[model samples]
Target: MLSDRRLFLLTLGSASLASLAACASGPQRVERPMNGDFPGIPFADWTDQEPEYLLYPGDEIEVATPTASELTRTVRIGPDGRIALPLIGSVMAADRTLPQLQQVVSAAYAPQLVRPTVEVTLRQAGPIRVWVDGEVRTPGVFEMIGDLDAYQAVIQAGGFAPTSRQDSVALIRRGPGGSRMMRVVDLRPRRGEVVPLRRGDIIFVPRSTLGELAAFFTQVRAALPIGFSYSINGSNGSGFAQF
Candidate 1:
């Protein structure tokens, strides 16, 4: 983490008046309401499966030979909703249907691998990384995978108490021109009534604007001291650990 004072200094140095105004005025793009009480997207039109047309990066997945019980499984998926297979490398797997991906994988491995058995499954689907960055009991990043709506996303971020303003949660997405804002979700517990998450989605549960200021101060109080650290990579087979 960058030091708070340094971060603030950097922000001040880099940002122009117009940029600050833009960031302060509001996030770009439209704002939709989270609750379905307003009534939209007539259930009939909503499909149970994601679109097989496009795949973005950051798709967490697991592939293995189910034919044998000795699970020879391997996995790979970045935070952007993509899958990496043996010969095919990384293919957009977020939106593609299973059958469609299966065919693609089979064809890719046909020449080099003999009877190359492969299966593509989304261990965690969706590219929406819900960043709970403000006042909450527990705050961090939650990978918005399959069936993870606002409520579930918040729960994974460790839920909220009475202090939480359910209606204040906002979803941030990057668009063609700039960062777009989509619907402020009112965190509520509901089973299977959430929208299907797409790749590159960023849901931020911000408190009220003043609440935002308080959050900033809270962060300031925590960073009285500064520090840094690093770790070495690479495991040499047998018992990879430091004593």
Candidate 2:
């Protein structure tokens, strides 16, 4: 039978070996909505699956018909979210997918022709509008062209100011339930650290807490006393008579 001390040493050695094996396996990648610290906040990845691209105002689309070339044309969604195609006249295009709009256009032209085939392709995406506020060189609403990350978005907004915090950034997103949630992004610029920005997303860069503490300490140091001196005066006896 094994003694108690021997059993204890054996267990400790096994634990150490397991820990070393875990380290050799390399660090695990962190997925968003991180554990205890960042609860309820979800960070979106740059290579996430393509979301349902809804048609919005100012979006340009190309419509084509295999059977009828005359019916094909490129059109833009108006401010009222409607597009004027060749034969379909004015059709609602907002809040619709490309496939959905193609079906609508095909059905509209079906009455006028023996056979109508329609295809809709998004030629140009609408302004991917996002707001960059707090600690940036230029803080305002910006219309980004292509895929943008928080770091790239801040650069587009004129980069970070001197006081801007580069450690972490805040991203505000409106959830499907209409409630707003904020995620904290690490701005170390490591591989796989680029977080994709969505339309209506808000990026806020704050001042560093360590910077504030340093400033406070500087002020305190300036106000502190450099040096001090003290002197005591004593008089003996009376004038000079008693000793």
Candidate 3:
């Protein structure tokens, strides 16, 4: 009978062998759709046209009430995505368009005033961040605004590197259902490419075809075994050999 330690090792080795057998067919790459526009982004009305900039953390805005000038003051959205107002206390501002925030402010003050005329204007835009990784000059998180598009974001990251596959850049976005969706966007220069990037998006520029082949060879080299052997000897030390 094998010692407890040897038995445990034997069980682990058996499981690993089974897993390897199941994967004998090798990795099957999923063929994703490649297109000019990014999926999940609303782009029908997208142009060089400016988006209805949503309020986010670090944004500065002035809320003006025609009747109540005292309530009209410039305030910065806190990191918590909320703003403190004298009457309304703390109001959630993140992810809300200017008009939507105006409505929220007005409703909050409805009990105080018969009709509160609330006008919200962006005093100054603030730092908005997105992750730009893979095959760019600088692959990291970057700060940008609402109008920033995928092209511009890549440029800000020091543009594409020589190893980049410009035709198939992946834009990973988190859907409202809390699931992530990936869309391979064609970044070839063209006239009036109007796709816009959003906050917290990940822009991954895949490696060129040549680089992909090199990666596959590296994987093969790492996985290929030159020699191996394992056996159990009766009463003698456990038999295991490798070369």
Candidate 4:
């Protein structure tokens, strides 16, 4: 089985494609459509006027919960996409939207609760980390926040170096069809290109595209022992050596 750190690094190593796509796709801006009483986030932050927040696989939501007589009492769904409600058992709550989930839950309780004023709230926001690796001056991790663009990620990594890969700055992201890796608008400084990056993304700045895969592996190997040593020593400095 793969270790957690390896899994995390692998996820980071692979997602550079999304970063590339974001740059290549270019930044798009537009207005958000209205959905009944629900509010809409402006499109000024999206690419091609896409949804403000790209929904992912394991997003968490919690309802403020209605009164005992108002709902099926207290039915909540776990992060694993399973829910053991007052009546309904585990049901897939994967891609369904908030409104869609509310409707589904309420519908099930129609025979019990009245009208069911449902409210969907994000209980545990999914992982929204951005990873920056290779050649960059300060390659590491970044938190994905409001309107984070690809340019922003590179900048956060303490900017590129003189011997920087420049053109091969790869940004990887995940979507419906597994994952797509592409070369985005060339990272020529001051080109006014580069798209906004997303959560669970990995941006790689290599010396050149020709040997980046090898470079990444080399970097990982060198990093592993140090990282492991640091963690072990950190948990218990002198005690670690005693074991």
Candidate 1 lDDT by residue in tens digits, 134-168: 44667755655566665666677677655554554
**TM-score of each candidate structure, all chains considered together:** 0.37, 0.48, 0.51, 0.46
Q: Provide the lDDT at 36 for model 1.
A: 38
lDDT of 3 at 81: 74
Q: By lDDT, who's the top model here?
A: 3
CA lDDT of each candidate? 0.45, 0.60, 0.61, 0.50
Query: What is the C-alpha lDDT profile of model 4 across 1-243, one tens digit per residue?
Result: 333244334433443333334346765331121222112211111133323243333455564346553333333343334455555555555445677767887776677665556666656665466777667788766767777877678788888876665654555444332322333335667864667776656676655333444555565565454332112123433222111
Give lDDT tens digits, candidate 2, residues 147-230.
Answer: 888889888878888876554565665444233444556665454267788876777665643344344345345434332111
In model 1, how large is the Cα lDDT of residue 205? 49
CA shift at 80, candidate 4, in angstroms? 7.6
Candidate that beats the other on lDDT, 1 or 2, i.e. the better one: 2
Candidate 2: the clashing residue pairs are none
- The model with the greater lDDT, 3 or 4, is 3
Candidate 3 per-residue lDDT, tens place, 1-243, comes to 222222222222322232234346554332233222233322122122344566767789998898988878789887657889878899988778888999999999999877798999998877667777667998766777548888888899899898776655656554442233445566766732445887656776766533444443453454344322212111343211111
The deviation in Å at residue 106 for candidate 1 is 24
Winner of 2 and 3 under lDDT: 3
Which residue pairs show collisions in model 1? Answer: 32-183, 57-80, 57-81, 58-78, 58-79, 58-80, 58-81, 59-81, 59-82
Model 4 segments more than 4 A misplaced: 1-49, 52-61, 64-96, 103-118, 122-129, 144-147, 161-163, 174-183, 192-194, 199-201, 215-243
